[model samples]
Each structure stands twice: as structure tokens, then as C-alpha cells.
Target: APFRMSFAASAKHVRVLENAGLVRRKVHGRSHVIRLNPAPLAAADKWLRYYERFWRERLDTLEALIRAEDKAATRKRSRK
Candidate 1:
């Protein structure tokens, strides 16, 4: 493998994510099967969607302001 992570290190992070309700792990003999629990993910996506819209509108307003400033500058330059 090109990476240098030990199994212990991997398992530690898995435990954190599992505790956060992001993943589910099943132990079958020596094999540990990990899967995503999408409920938490869906909740996060729904929460973030509001901010996404908010920021998009904010950025759009910012862009409009910049464009208006550029137009004003252009008009001033043309008058010179």
C-alpha cells in the first residue's frame, strides 16, 4: 500500500465516526464491515441547505455591488 496507516489508527477514527452516528460497524470474525448510516447525513444536508441558499444570495448581492461599482467607475472615467 502507498499509505502508512496502522490498523489501530484506522479503528480509532472509525470509533469516533461511529460514535458521531455517521457510520455503523459490524464485526464478523476478524473482518470489520463498515457502512454509512445515511439518516445523520440526510439531516446534515437538510440543515446545510439553508446556509447554502443564504450564502448564494449573499454572494449574488456582493457580485451585483461590485458590478455596479465597476459601472460607476467606468462612467467616471468616460467623463474624464
Candidate 2:
């Protein structure tokens, strides 16, 4: 917010954010006031957490399988 950018680029970025439902812009005379809308961002966070848990469980299972296979290979070599 402290930094400066071109008006055209700033408007384009604002438009993209508006389209994504992350912000709401209201025009007061010649000035545009932008407000943050948290609902969409919260929903996206929830979606990401759900998939994070899913991948964690999947990777745990894969790790267990790999460990078991390594132990089996070690035993086979020790018996030779």
C-alpha cells in the first residue's frame, strides 16, 4: 500500500481481484473505495486444508509401504 504503481496496472489488478470475489469496489464520486471480502478467501483456505489432510494420509501410507519393503529386502540379504 505504501508503494506506487501505474494507474492502469493498479486498475487491472483491482479488476482481477474484484472478479475473483476477493474485493468489492464502491465508487464515491471520482474516488473508488475497495473493501476486502473474506468469504471467498476463507472457502479457498478450507478447500486447501481438506486436500492437505488427504495428501498427508496418502503419503503416510506410502511411507509405511516403503519401510516394510526395505525391511523385507534387508532380511533377505541377511539370510544370504
Candidate 3:
């Protein structure tokens, strides 16, 4: 095998993906062709993007707060 896994292990992984609706397998005689089902992945991508933006906004706010605190500390140091 080009990969580290044996054929049986690879088949098990493919079966899991098929059960999850993440892949479709077509069998022709001795050959099996596996194709990815992109719908689930696309939905996951959309979900992740929303959270990415949410966290980005939250992090930006946190950065602004930290910077304000730092500036206040500097001003206090200058006055002392």
C-alpha cells in the first residue's frame, strides 16, 4: 500500500465515511469508485465561517480593551 494502512483498514474507513454520508461508493465488478459528497462539507464550512466571524469580532473587542488598558497604564506611569 502507498499509505501506511492495510487494505482492510482503508475499507473500514471508507465504510465509515459512507455511513456518515460523506462519500458515495460505486462498485463495478472488482473495481470500486468512491466519490466525496460535498453537501455535508459545505454545510460544515458555512457553520464554521459563522463562528469564525463571531470569534474574530470577539477577539477584536478584546484587543481593543487590552490596548485601552495599556494606554491608561502608560498615562499613569507618565503622571508618576
Per-residue lDDT value at 22 in model 1: 99
lDDT of 2 by residue, 1-80 (tens): 56598888899999999999999999999999999999999999999999999999999999999999999999999999
Model 3 lDDT tens row, 1-80: 59999999999999999999999999999999999999999999999999999999999999999999999999999998
Model 2 clashes, total count: 0
* Worst ten in a row by lDDT for model 3: 1-10
* Model 3 residue 65 CA deviation in Å: 0.4
Candidate no. 3 TM-score:
0.91
Scored by lDDT, the top model is: 3
**Each prediction's number of clashing residue pairs:** 0, 0, 0
What lDDT does each candidate get?
Answer: 0.95, 0.97, 0.98
lDDT of 3 at 5: 94
**Cα RMSD, model 2:** 1.8
Stretches of candidate 2 exceeding 4 Å from the true structure: 1-4
Lowest summed lDDT window (length 10), candidate 2: 1-10
